[model samples]
Target: MLWWGKEMNEWQVLHASDLDFLLENSSSPYDYSGDNNESEYCCGTPPCSQDFTFDRTFLPVLYSLLFILGLLGNGAVAAVLLSQKAALSSTDTFLLHLAVADMLLVLTLPLWAVDAAVQWVFGSGLCKVAGALFNINFYAGALLLACISFDRYLSIVHATQLYRRRPQARVTLTCVTVWGLCLLFALPDFIFLAANHDERLSATHCQYSIQQVGHTARALQLVAGFLLPLLVMAYCYARILAVLLLSRGQRRLRAIRVVVVVVVAFTICWTPYHLVVLVDTLMNMGALARNCSQENHVDVAKSITSGLGYMHCCLNPLLYAFVGVKFRERMWQLLIRLGCPEQREHVRQLSRRDSSWSETTEASYSGL
Candidate 1:
């Protein structure tokens, strides 16, 4: 993973015909290169007023950066959480899953970066596997975020014992169930993504063509993965805010700030990508412009916003570190146990405060 940038360029041995195909139909990776005895094969698709070019060289750099940051941040969160799993809140379980999803997603990015710069050297099986993993993580992360928000809402706003007693079991099952659903949701990618070797380019590439699987998979992705999660998170956070406004406690106020940070960061990072994907879906379904210019814009928008979404993996662990005192406390404990002797005094102080906090109402205590 660390050496991805140097490794990605190792497969750039495009054949002469591949170079010619790239030079001719440079705008699209999906452009077919098979022999067309008839000119009609070239006639129908609209032409762009100007060539839409992207710096493919930048992709490897960008992917490498995301891989590093996301691996570090999420790895820390996962390490801390995993080390002390027996005593974490339900919300942290969702967070752990979120970090896992992001980490796995970023793991596959080097493959994509290489594919973008050159072509898909990996075969059909790998293409399907990568695609399935990507979709699974993408949807799983979004769903996990919603689950976290909802858990927070139940804890803060409703103050329900339903989540407090044996919460670990419930949360564990929830995580497992969600993961299963995500895998099922990802099956379409496994079925749809197959190598369409462009003979002219002398390159094998996985294409997501409508004729392969129709629009059902994409539609489900938009509705179930993107739209539904957004609606659930929005509702959960809104109700949380409404309840917090009426409450008067330092912990509740801190919780309010954490909720705001989580929701706002989520919106900023993911909304644009969903919007672009929605537009692209609509275009593919003939609900939007199908002109070459419009397609180029949508493709560029998806690429840019997708990178922005990738940063969310890095952003999430930062959010937890900055906003969740319990998370930070756990991290501190982990670090202390890992031989941060200088912070032993801090751990003592934390233990002292934990007992005091426990004597208070569970809400106030848990709010910490």
Candidate 2:
């Protein structure tokens, strides 16, 4: 199924004119080998994907390393959180889901990395599933960053008792809502992205089919992908920093640094990608410089920035380790439970801090 009946026609006969709006198309028209399947599915010159699909050697290696690191890192984070089970705080709950989302997003990178090295040979089914899954995780991760930041804001900036009241319910509801929105963002992919087989290049690609992409797509992409979460992160971190400033302690200062790092890392990794995509979307809709060089630049930027976005999966686990003292302590305990002797002394030093954090967790997110 094309996921939308009307969108089917565009796939069958995608003239260059139909794709002119999308800077995602290469500066040159996409050319597919002649075949019933190829003609019916993807028909375009490949995007100048070769120019910056990845840095080739280094990127594929990095992607592999990232996949390994992301798996181990996020897995450890999730494992520690799940160990708490019913006793999990709102912060723990958020961290669990964040790890889950990052893991899901990370799982798809191997396929993309393979594509980068050898091109997509997978058929239509994997394409649709992977594309939709990627969209869901990508959007969910972005939204959950906002949700996590808000959860922290409430714990740190608001009254303590008020923050903990039914926190389990609040976290559950927030997660459900975030997944719901992610589904909304993912649905379009089943219709838009599909498998395109080109035996000539010995490659089968998974990409968007040309259709009436313009204002609606641009608006949705802007709001859901870029604007909403950016606002949330900025607002929550700004408030958290402003409030924490009046308090005096190494802990408070550390909290400010963590919050700032969260915002900074997010901006550094995601903002360039979103902005490049946004500019491309605008050009596709005739609202920006629609020149060939400009389109090529946007495409290259999108490719690079997308890699950066994926790198977040690697960064997130480190964030968990660095930002939350409790997380590190818990991780150490988890390691010790698994019989890691090296973490024993480390766990001892963390005890005093852990107790202090536990005591004040009633007042702030120290235990989180």
Candidate 3:
């Protein structure tokens, strides 16, 4: 991974002509090559050069916006989940954890934007800590999503008296297990991240390079970070969908729709990012065959891929706003509470009455 920039130039020696041909045949309106060598041997060019000025200078501005929005949105979700008077069900528990994880992840955006603007100014220790925290949340979010899918499946397709007997204990245990696994997976990131100076660019970067462990570490990270979690999520959702189809209840259908929206939103937001990372990792490991003269083509590709990943930070809030109706309602209630105390009190009274009615109905059913 560390040698991606250097390796691209080497590959260009073997694949320059093919790359030139590709550029010529591309359907894009812009010129693919201006005044650069097309061979893989060339180390620098327009979009590929480390010094390539991003015309999108607004990226940092955009990141700052996302950072603010994500923090507020996820924090609200966490607050609503935490503040609810109802017993903490498995779904609520998982959503709370997911919000916490995403909030932590978004909090690091400003640091990254600063790094991108003026190079990595933070010391080695901070770098490692930041990287570890980011990975911890990343994995935690994935695990929680999978857990949510499985929980939905159980609540619907495999609904049974025993499953609901000790719901609180099960939810607590599952959350603990998720956190433990996230910490374990994040340990390497903590160890490997460090401050490094790029001589060519004259910039300092916070990065993870497993030069000592070589390809093995890269492979492990790819599997753990992308492939394994993806598979687990896919499997759980598939089973959840099957169970939902088999079940016959209005509540089951509503729950299924919520789970489906959550899963679909997650997939849409994360799939491109993971696919790009997987491809870039493969390329870094020399697993991808490339025919290009200039190393810049691959570099440009990487930059674009990274930008795509950064977009995921912003998409999470949209998912919550769109898929999580209860969260949205709570946010509106919070706004009302802040803006009009009398109205808020009236709303609270109505909410208490509704809860009392629900409990009365449950008590009557139990008595029967």
Candidate 4:
């Protein structure tokens, strides 16, 4: 089964006039597949087949480090949240979901690294599961972050009686809805991800093939995975900043700073990855057909973009550690609880502060 129809005819066979016309009119004429027999379509020329090389030397090391750190960090956050007896506030609820998303996403890293190091030995079933989970976790995290920003904006700027009525329940329901949406969005990966053998590389790759409904899958990813979430996040943060500027208080300022940091970190980590994905999608669509010779450069750019994305997996845990004071206090309490009974009072006080901080801040922001 060929993805994107059989390879196109070679570029070299076209007369100079045709070539000139194509170059002049098309943005990316080289993106189309040419006949394999044509000199122009040969490896050394423009429109040449891409040589995707998997560099295995550092894959194992990188995966092992990320797996260990991501699990430990995110696990600590989950442990702290679970141990608390307080009814989950909206922030707590969102943080818990964010930690879970990060943890689940990192869980699949080892599998990907193994695929990078060797032929995808894990069969089609495993590939589909991994790919689906990866997309679900990624989109879920983005959605949760946007939700967090909106929650902050509501609590700070638009404080109304509506917030007081079952705030926790509403937040829980929102988180559930986000997860449900993410799962639906991820459905295509489960259906379309396949294991294919590349004869040239003598390796099996777990990739989305162009056959069948791949184009639909790509379009869905572009919209759901990137565009929609980004638009929402941007709007939420913009409103958040506006509100922060209007309401002046030390506590409000601190909260705004933390929220801004979270948003900026998310943007820094995800923007490049999405940009690369957009570029790759466009390239595949022949948007850059005339620039086929630029493929090598584009491939290099993609590598950098992907690397930045991978780094975000590690950075998320660090962000939580720094941003959430409750997280830090609880982590410390856990450690102290393991060592001495004398620290129990301190832990209790910290928990109390964690639970009450929002309510107390609520009154101040409520213009009371």
lDDT of each: 0.68, 0.66, 0.59, 0.64
| Candidate 1 backbone overlaps, count | 1
After superposition, candidate 4 runs with Cα above 4 Å error: 1-54, 161-163, 211-216, 290-293, 340-368
What TM value does model 4 have? 0.78
Q: Which candidate comes out best when scored by lDDT?
A: 1
Model 1 score (lDDT): 0.68
Q: Could you give candidate 4's per-residue lDDT for residues 285-359 as a string of tens digits?
A: 657553655655665555555556656666766765687565566677777867867877876876686664654
User: Over the stretch 122-189, how does candidate 3's per-residue lDDT look in tens digits?
Assistant: 88888778777877887787778777666554544455422376877877888898899888877776
lDDT string for model 1 (1-368, tens) is 11111111101223456557755774744344555733322335633332214626556678889989999999998998888746766665676788899999989888887776677778878878988898899889888878877777776677764566677788888899899999999887787677665443455556553342535665676788878988998898888777767765555556456546866787798788777767766665567657767766766776677788778878978887877666677788888888897887886776676554433323532432
Top TM-score model: 1
Q: Which is better, 3 or 4, measured by TM-score?
A: 4
lDDT minimum window of 10 residues, candidate 2 = 1-10
Candidate 3 Cα outliers beyond 4 Å, as residue runs: 1-49, 55-59, 160-166, 212-218, 246-251, 291-298, 304-307, 336-368
Stretches of candidate 1 off by over 4 Å are 1-55, 199-202, 209-214, 345-368
